[model samples]
Every structure is written in C-alpha cells, then in structure tokens.
Target: MQHEHWWPRPYRFDALLAPGVARARDCAGGIIVVKQGGVPAPLLRLRHPHLAAVVAADCHHHVLAWAGGVPMARLAGRVPVAAAVRWTGQLLAALACLHDAGVVHRDVTAANAMVVGTDAVLIDYGLAAPPGSCAVAGTPASTAPEGWRGHADARSDLFAVGVLLYRLLTGRHPFPGPPFAALQRILHGPVAAPSTQAPQCGSAFDPLLARALAARPSDRFASAAAMAAALDAAQAAFKLHCAANGGLARVAGECRKNGNRNDKYRERERKYRV
Candidate 1:
C-alpha cells in the first residue's frame, strides 16, 4: 500500500470501518486510524479542549481518535443565532489555542468543525502551518482574499470563521456561486451583512463579520481571543434582546426543528452527555 510506510512499529493499520474514519478521510487534513498503539509523542504534546485528539502518527500521516458529532455543515440555517454565536466562540477559542502554539490552521471551514453536545471541536490539521507561511491552501469559498495571493496567517483563519458564521446564520455562503466566481467575489465583491440575508440574525453580526472578513489582515481582529471576546459580547446582547422581546420561544422552536431534522445527531449527543 502507498501508506504502508506511514505507520511505524506497534501501530498497524486498522480496518477503517468507523463513522469517524469516513469523516476524517473526507476532511482536508485526512486523519486516519492505526490499530493498537499510544498517540505519537509529537501529536500528544499539544492539548486543548476544542482540538481533536490524535491516536497515533508518523512523518506523513496522523491517526486521530474519531471526533464523533455532526459536521457544522449539516446545521446550516437550522442553528439558532445564540447557538451559532456560542459555537463560533468555541471555534475561535480553538484557533486561539492553535495560534498560541505557533500553529495556524490554514483550513477552517464548516466541514472541518464538529458539533459535539453543546460544544464545537476543530478537527483536521493536514494543512496547518507556522505563521506567515503563504501556502495558498484551503477551500476557496472560505479562503481570505490574501490567501489567493499565497498568504495565510491567524487572520486568514478568522476570515474562514466569518464564512462559517455566515453560513450558520443565513444557511448560505456569503459569496455563493461557482468556485471561481466565489473566489472573485471574496477578492473584490461586497458581502451583504448577515442580517440582510436573515433578519433574525440582527444587525450586531454585521460589523463583526465586516471586521472578520476584512480585505486586509491589519483590518481584522488582532487575535482569535479578541474575536472570541467580541462574539461573547454579541451573544450576550442577543440574549438580552430575546428575553425582552419574547424571542426565546422562536429560538426554542428553531432548536426543536433542528433536532427533528437530525435525530441521529441528537442520539449521539445523548450518548456523549451520558
């Protein structure tokens, strides 16, 4: 096999028959499984609540313990604004941890985030690189404008988070169309505010997304922690508005609808909670 050399002693290839295996394969980082071994030394060193755990690894590949949950992609348009805000905060926290470790997650798309219980976890580190790597990698729809010009850093990752938040709020990409067209829109076209696409999201998201998806790195949040703090404030304000206007019922209704649509995920969530 082409990957026969990827696994070293004591860690043999397992029969890749888990749900997480499929998801890992589908992810950009492409983490896989290797049977019966401790997590590799290098992979085990970095630890964070929101980062997926690695099971084993070698120079060419990493075997991550399956992070079982629904992909954020599946929750599009169904997530309540409060839930979306919370999840985005969790992802930003994850990014902060990665950034602090001197690593930049070049790929930060909806498909790369998994919702486990009430929390969000960031998976797949295949494209991760040190700061200022300028690799020109990541999914086009979520890539920052500077990314197309072969630059990627913490701010570039934040841009992708903005894209994910837009999808979660409005159930669509900000720059929707064919790949090239979307890339062009990201580069030069204007993005409508999330409230414009889905009024329920409110206007607070407008300025936040504007800053997050800014054309220039210097114009975006200074750090992931800073962005997360802003999101927390937005979430708090949203809660107050809902409580005063009786919007809590609407939020609950949306959660119920989403639960009905994803019964399996609810079951998985129950298992995790147990």
Candidate 2:
C-alpha cells in the first residue's frame, strides 16, 4: 500500500538515464539516508528537481527540490497578514497552471511549500492526479471532506489553499488536530471568521476565506481565479478602511502578537505586505 504512492522509483528513471549516486556525509534532524537509485545524474538535469526521480536506499530517500527555503509552518504567527496575502496570490497562480493542465494537486500544505525571498513555490506533486481520481489523497488536515468519498476536482485544491491561507493569516488552523481529531475538526469544527483570531486580517478578509474554506465544495469559490479576485478585492477594501480609520500601521503590530505571524512589512511596509 505504501509503495503504491511512492514517486516513480529511481530505476524507472535509470532505464532512461543514470546519475552518479553519492551519499551525504551527514544527515539532518538525526536521520542519515544512504541514497540508492539507478537514475543517472544527467536524467535529473532534464527533469524538474522537485519532481526528480531519485529513489533512496530505503523507500524514502527521495530528494525534493534543489532549493532551500523556510517552510511556512516554521514562520507561523510571524507572518503578517499582508505577507500572507501576497504568498496566497503566488500560490493561486501556481494552481492556475496546474488546473489549466487538468491536474489537481491533491496535497498542498505548509510542509509542501516553501517561501523563498518574496515568492512561494508549490511543491510535492507526488499526489497530484487528474480530476476524478479522488482516492483520498493529501494530508488529512488539508484534504477536502469530499475527497474521502468522491472525486476531488480543482475546487478541492482551492479548499486546501484556503486552509493554508487561513493558517498563514491567522496562525491558528481553522481546524486543529493530530489525526482523527483533526479530521473531525475539519468535518465538524467551526469556520470562524479570520478576523476573530487576527483582527489585523480585518473583517473584509474573512468572507472571502470563509467561502474558500467552506466544507461543501459547492460552497467554495468557483475557481482559483475567483479566489484571487476576491482576495484582491478584500485587500482593496482593507486599504480604504485603513485610510479612513487613520491607523494603517496598527495591523502590523497585532501580527507580531500572533495570528499567522509573518514579517513582510520590514521590506516595504503595507504596499505589498500580506
């Protein structure tokens, strides 16, 4: 069952090309992986590094992406609302490309994405499948409830994105849990407005995310483009409100307190924050 989902093994790629295999002298987090794969290094040159086909000595020695960046999870409660919003746009853009290709990235979580410089790249396509191959793929916390019982379409990806965005902006997951508890939370938990947890998010931001995180697929945004537009509108509204209220800087202070921590403000203040 586990192998069923393994990314194509290195031998699969090796038949076409072989890469020199070298093991890292040291391992991170106390796990050392001696690599074993037949795919020649040249083959990787032709493939996207993140999706490269390099099998490990065991079953999990897969190396994903040649780049390193901070996982958004580690940046929780430090990401400002504005910074979160900016990242959301980039994520949506990446999804648009996937949806255009008729694929659904079944799994999209903070662990699956990394923030580098000012942009975020969506990673971990091992579970990405065409529409109608529901099969319950993806992290439990991020999976759409319908995925457990039906085919998850593009909207399903949007739902996962919504979950991510919510966490990014609020620091707290709309549904929190370890496994069964988290699944139950996703299935039966409350969808509180983002503002409730992070006032910096502003009330306008809540409605848009609410629709994205809606339990019912039909209740969510119709598409990634729609979600992006709604996000843009919310940002505009927030800006106007800030202008009228006379305290635009206040939002960043609360972000420091908690509520999806991020620090985009230090770069250029509110112009592109969130």
Q: Give each model's whole-structure lDDT.
A: 0.72, 0.66
Q: How close is candidate 2 to the true structure, as a TM-score?
A: 0.73
Error of 2 at 238 (Å): 1.9
| Quality of model 2 by C-alpha lDDT | 0.66
- The clash tally of candidate 1 reads 0
Write the residue-wise lDDT of candidate 2 on 1-274 in tens digits: 2222244333232221224322232223222112332222222233332232323322333433334567777655565556777888888877876776666878888876678666676655556667888377778888988877768889999988888888876777888758888788677667888788877666878888878877788998888899999989988887876666566666666666653434554653433354
TM-score of 1: 0.79
| Candidate with the greatest lDDT versus the true structure | 1
lDDT of 1 by residue, 10-113 (tens): 44443456433432343344434432222223344677788886654544556666656789998876656766777888899888878887777788998889
Candidate maximizing TM-score: 1
lDDT of 2 at 110: 83
Clashing pairs in 1: none
Can you tell me which runs of candidate 1 are displaced by over 4 Å? 1-10, 15-44, 251-274
